[model samples]
Target: MAAEVKLAVRGAGKRYGEMDALKDCSLDVAPNSIVSIVGPSGCGKTTLLWSMSGLHGLTSGEVLLDGRRITGPHPDIGLVFQEANLLPWRNLMDNILFPFEVKHQKPDHGWIAHLLERVGLTGFEKNFPNELSGGMQQRASIVRALSLRPSVLLMDEPFGALDAFTREEMNQLVEEIWMETHTTIVFITHSIEEALFLSDKVVVLTPRPGRVLNTYEVPFERPRTMEIMAGKEVYDLTYRIKADIYGQSRMQARAAE
Candidate 1:
């Protein structure tokens, strides 16, 4: 069964001086479900995430978690950035436990071990980020985020830096962990295929002064594979989204001339 709504952004807007980065943006995210946000470059995808994370407050509207307002960073929200951002000097174990240390919360070794095993970094606890492969480093970074045991995970282009092959592997890993942990996730990406593959719902945003263009409910069953990308339904959806984004880009250019 699908989960209940756990996070929401209601009429959220953020402005930088005279520029509006996000305007009247709102979304309801379900518990234990994955939502992907996609948009053209400079469309405030990252800005929306920053607002949701409570790293920056919205100039208008609100972000809610469990029905309460998000005034700032909370323990229940965990963020993973585009880079793995692991400390080069810290070993896998130490790096994963870093969040707890900063939060002044007691480290849960058992939970940490479980996450390491789940992400396939079980025996490499002693290895530094430099000692791990790109995929492995990312896995460790995920473990670090999960260590907080946050109800929601916000990921911003987490795999955008990896090669195509490694990115696919990381996708599979994320799928496995999401299923196991039932954590709500809001992921931002430029790839429509990635959005389709990883999301329960996909939100496409318009160009700057960003607003929702459309939201799609992904219909494919779980345990999804790369082969699903080749299906006619997936192809049609991909084509339509690309056309929508391209169409908007041209419109914006024409207006600027």
Candidate 2:
């Protein structure tokens, strides 16, 4: 374990004009643990990820990485957006090396190759984004993010666009990567099953002007699988989270009315 606290969000808030996307949200991610955020739409889950990555400025509070305040993006944090966002003109290897290029650092071919292999993109290194399947493209994108050797990985619905089978496979892939690297991960998702399957803790949020509704610790043992997910304990946790999100959505509707 790296330390007790890998990332900490304290009173974190973000606003767009009159709209408060997040408010008074606080959470601590233990080192090398997998944490997932789940909530109704417009609940600022993505904003929280952006704030943690320093991609968006915070209106108040602070995001700390390994006890240091993150005033701006740090090289040790990697983000995987919903879209693969791969450049059509670039080959897989080139795309994975893009981060080093932007930072004006020399490309680490060895690490890039290793990441490609890890993501199962070893044979497609010279292929363009258009030549790959949706799942493969996302795999490449993940490898690109990991190429920087980030200690913390921030994922915002990275598997949302894929088909159900593909999404499930990607979920397993993420778990495999986490187990292999012991990297701290904060994933945002709308799927209760996915969150329950992969997370050590699932943080539930309310609708806009989001606040932490609850945090559920997954009692299942590590190295989770589809079999574990079929267990009653896992199903119960998923049902509970689903109910929380449903209730929050209803509350938002009433408040708007």
Candidate 3:
């Protein structure tokens, strides 16, 4: 829908021995847009995200970024997982800057400071992961992934581990980051509310051996507030998307498992 595709998944699929994880999956991501993928349990959501990262190979298709094929991990892409995965021994700032050390590259301290400020992690730089709360740790993880200023960020349920309040706060933080940086993102989540609240478009995947089912555009305007979720439109769309996911013999449960 948005002009000029930044990332494309073409007839993609992945099979492991006798188990098929994804099949004929295809989608396009326009630059700076947030696309959320949701589906039932074991629907290959993680598999698909991994394939896009080029960290895992697809059995049947390809992923292209900026018209170039992604055969392996690309520097322009970054990932954040459900857990912060921070090192216990390192201070927060060192952990955030770990990627730079791995690449033997000099980090732009200004960029680090800006990202830390954006994520509300500025003064906590000296704290270790053990000293920070879960939300703070996750924020550190986000900043770490973003330290290199990747063009596209692939997030696999990055906020799934937090409490409802903390998750909402992270969602707000994500929206702010996206607006400020205009970084393209493909987020995988099981929460339809979370997906609708944060994405420009919500992508639905079928049950196991997952494939693209449908994509719904979020008609809400930008700079959305939490109040949008309590409104009738989101309420209506939520059920509609649920019907789409449920129609396939799978229903959402809340943690939804």
Candidate 4:
């Protein structure tokens, strides 16, 4: 039997004035699974991510967690965006513990320290955001989001600002975090290969007024390695995903003409 859906987007749609950003985009995320969203530029991937996080409301549908409708931000969800967005003055440990202070909860030093080490930020606790490298700052941002131990994490191209080598390292770190915490993640990115590398399922969306074009269940078993990305199957799936996106783009253009 299929696993229980930890997060569900039911016929979700969003309209910005006359612009329809998304339409009937529904998806299910299984517990402990990594699901990646990919599509052409401006296909509303980030909008959908926000909708799931309950930060943005849908015009037509609803998002649910454990079958409960999300009308606004829930304690069980956390967000990480492209930039580290850390406060320059806070220092690593303080930044990671900021979430606890927001909710008026006491900080969990043990968990924070463990997450810091997992993301390779252990010794940098005393360092300010500027003291860290780009990748290190991003890692600190991730640890901050995960600090609350939310059941679901929404990542909007969290590593898009990093260099290629650092991006790959961060991707591996994302997988490791999911494997360790079993936190269901909905990652948004434009890179097909990166999506395939890190997701249990890679979901492709159509151009403007984004809708689900296709979903590919990655056949590779975990713990996944970069070597899987070099295989023929990866190339084949990549080709198919591109074809789906490009083919839809062409059809949309013709309709406009």
Per-residue accuracy of model 1 over 1-257 as CA lDDT, tens digit each: 85567999899888999999999998899888899999999999999998899999999999999889999998899999888999998998899888888878899889989998898899999998898998888889999999979999999999999998888888888889988888999999998988888999999899988999988888887779767867988888888888889999999899999
Residue pairs clashing, model 1: none
lDDT measured at residue 17 in model 1 versus the true structure, 0 to 100: 97
The clash tally of candidate 2 reads: 0
> Whole-model lDDT for model 3 versus the true structure?
0.91
Residue 194's lDDT within candidate 4 is 89
Candidate 4, residue 137: how far the Cα is off, in Å:
1.0
- Clash pairs, candidate 4, are none
State, as a TM-score between 0 and 1, how close model 1 is to the true structure. 0.95
Better of 1 and 2 by lDDT: 2
Candidate 2: segments with Cα more than 4 A from true spot = 1-3, 255-257
Candidate 3 TM-score, true structure as reference: 0.94
lDDT of 4 by residue, 92-197 (tens): 8888888887889998889988999899888999999998899999999999999888999999998888899999899889988988998999999988988999
Q: Candidate 3: which stretches are off by over 4 Å? A: 1-3, 250-257
**All models, RMSD in angstroms:** 1.9, 1.9, 3.3, 1.3
After superposition, the stretches of candidate 4 with alpha carbons farther than 4 Å from their true spots are 1-3
Q: What are the per-model numbers of colliding residue pairs?
A: 0, 0, 1, 0
lDDT per residue for candidate 3 within 10-125, as digits (tens), equals 99989989999999999999898999999987999999999999998998889999999999999999999878899999999999879999999999999999999988888999
Task: Count clashing residue pairs in model 4.
Answer: 0
What is model 4's C-alpha RMSD? 1.3
Give the clash count for model 3. 1
For model 4, the local distance difference test gives 0.91
